[model samples]
Target chain A: MITSLSVQWRMDEFCELAGLPAECLIEIVEQGILDPGGQAPEEWLFDAAALAIAKRAARLQRDLEIDWPGIALALSLLDELEQLRAENAMLKRRLGRFLQE
Target chain B: MLEPQGSSMDFKDYYAILGVPDSADDKAIKTAYRKLARKYHPDVSREAGAEEKFKEVAEAYEVLGNAEKRAEYDEVRRYGRAGAGFEVPPGWQRSGSFGDYAGHPGRDFSDFFEAIFGSAGRAGEAPGRGREGGRRGQDVEMELPIFLEDTLADESKKILYQVPQYDSAGRRLADIDKTLNVKIPPGVGDRERIRLKGQGAPGIGGAPNGDLYLVIRLVPHPLFDVEGHNLIITVPLAPWEAALGTKVTLPTLKGKVNLTIPANSQTGQRLRIKGRGLVSKLGTTGDLYALLKVVMPSRNDEATQQLWKQLAEQAGFDPRTEWSKRP
Candidate 1:
């Protein structure tokens, strides 16, 4: 079966795919880098987006040597910047549609 | 470029990749690596070819960061390269010590890296694959581009990708091409991924195959723009159509429908058509927003200009009165 947005992974599968330990995942969750569904680690379910972000967090930790808090802040800022850029481009395109060249 | 060159491999200059000097110390090497990594990391960098550049940088740091690897690398450099190819001299012994390295997840260790360090930390070979036996296969990740129209309905896509193959001995073999037909559910957005377990590279010794992740990218639509699940379509109207009420036919993804443009409508105003946008996975449809844009005719004949002059005199309208209260 192809898992869509509705599908999610248990902790074990998430750890396997992300190549991170449970402790690291907990640290990331505590730092607000990942907010997976459910309350406890065992009960939590990680989606594909969370998987991708978890891997990115792992990279930031491994390559940049950044602490959990630092990585969390960086991820938050980077996400906001990406959203703002996409919104800005959409707005610019909309404006262009109305205005003559 | 990292492919095995038999006894000879290209002597990739780690220093050049990091833009550092040959005699650069640990601190200098680190600073250079960090700068390049931050700039070239595909997740963050917006530049073209950032991923390829980051791989070179990361690979360079992998060897140079460790003292043992660096020493071994230096010794090999003494042999010198012959026409872009460096051959390991006879009786070359690798350093027994290996660093504790978990490379960037998707970063494939180049042929040069495997040639030097062996396949212990490369892409497919996990640490104990040979000894343990029945090793799981490598996971594959690829982007699957779908049209905007497809997101509103159940769509099936055909994918062609290559997966790494290995014999029972866990030795590297030629990759085999595979094809899969995937069904995409409605309401999928950009950057979302669909996972297919046990569909990636085949496992060795009957171990379970790895999973495949298909990241979705929505192609831009010519007529509609997506915001969340809602779609926005520009409705261009003539000056008369904007000032006076008019009925016009609008095209929707499903079909064309007649729409009424209210009198005295202004540009940039939106008219929302409910339940006409993209559908959600939970079976809810978003609204379609029709953004109004008013335009003047390209040319006016003498008779039309006279009529416009008469109307301007009679109407006596000031469109920019709000501008007078500027801060």
Candidate 2:
């Protein structure tokens, strides 16, 4: 079937795709690792970004053997580091253009 | 121990995969696996083929990490390289099967793994494979790299991926190739996931088929760098251009436009070009930023160097004045 990223998954579907339990997902949301829409679990709507973040969070938790809080902190720091690195790379590229003969 | 096929594939040495000695203890093996896993984990590393390397490492750990599996593997290895005609030796039964690279998005095990451990008993035979008396299909994931220009319009991308095939009894035969024409939504950024329902592995025993997830990866553009929806292009300028105002042709994703570099503009200064970047899902356009870079001639002749020296003496600019602010 032809599909796009406009797919917004609910709690149950998100759980299955991410291979995570409901409580763990709820805990991740509580830890600020994921911020889905709506007020409650049943009413929650997770967009494409939320699903990707959830999968990444699950991997971090599983492979690194980190707790929810730790995973949250790690995700936050990793996001910051990625942005910083991108900026650095862009600057370096610009510098190379200037320094090049 | 599982009964081997008539002709076996190359045997993967778990010890070699994990980079541990044959006589390495559990602690040593665990340490080695952890070090390699951290180095090669797909999520953590960007090294080419890191995921494949991590898969091998994880599969190795699945056996070596367990005492029973490791012992069984060791005994099997003692029988020499079972190449053409190999047997599992009578009276030994394959107990449990390994996971599909535990905790990975893609539920795929290698042919070597299947031949050695046998496919994870599907159809309620294994501990967790079955759901409601039948096994649910494995989910498939593939990376889809889209060009930076693709974010502007609703484009259709043709993708080819393989879906795992299983028989009625849940023994994996081989993967069947599936081709699809996927329509990508406009403004999908890097790392966005598109889910296609019931397009993964086929279900067995009336179970529901798995969903396929397409992970978006934005291809790097030669002329522009992405910052969210906005694009940044470094504008190269000579020393005279920075001093005196100039109009130069700048390239955007849409087309070429004339950009004005204001007089006395400093290096690294950004000039904003409104509504010249990527289109957003909400039908709004992002602005592009033109970054200024003052480049000098690599090799200066006597006349050029003399002119620069004269300009420096006349300019009387000391950039080091900021150093005096330190208390």
TM-scores, each model vs. reference: 0.90, 0.76
Clashing pairs in model 1, backbone N/Cα/C closer than 3 A: B2-B111
Interface RMSD for candidates 1 onward, in order: 3.0, 4.1
- Give lDDT tens digits, candidate 2, residues B178-256: 9888888888877677888888887777777877889888887888988778898988899899999799999998789
Candidate 2, RMSD to the unseen true structure: 4.9
Task: Report DockQ per prediction, comma-separated.
Answer: 0.50, 0.46
Candidate 2 residue pairs that clash: none
Query: CA lDDT of B303 in candidate 2?
Result: 95
- Tens digits of per-residue lDDT for model 1, B1-327: 225457766778887888888899999999999999888887789899998898889889988887877887777666765357776668866664543344444456667776677655444325223235676677778999899888877778888998887677445678888889888878888878887888878878877787788888888778888888899999999999999979989888899878899999999999998888999878899989999999899999999999999999999999889998897
- The alpha-carbon lDDT assigned to residue A12 of candidate 1 equals 77
The interface root mean square deviation of candidate 2 comes to: 4.1
Off by over 4 Å in 1: A1-3, A37-39, B1-8, B81-83, B99-107, B121-132, B166-172, B325-327
lDDT of 1 by residue, A1-101 (tens): 46555568898777776767789989998988888867788888888778889988888887777899989998999999988987897788777787889
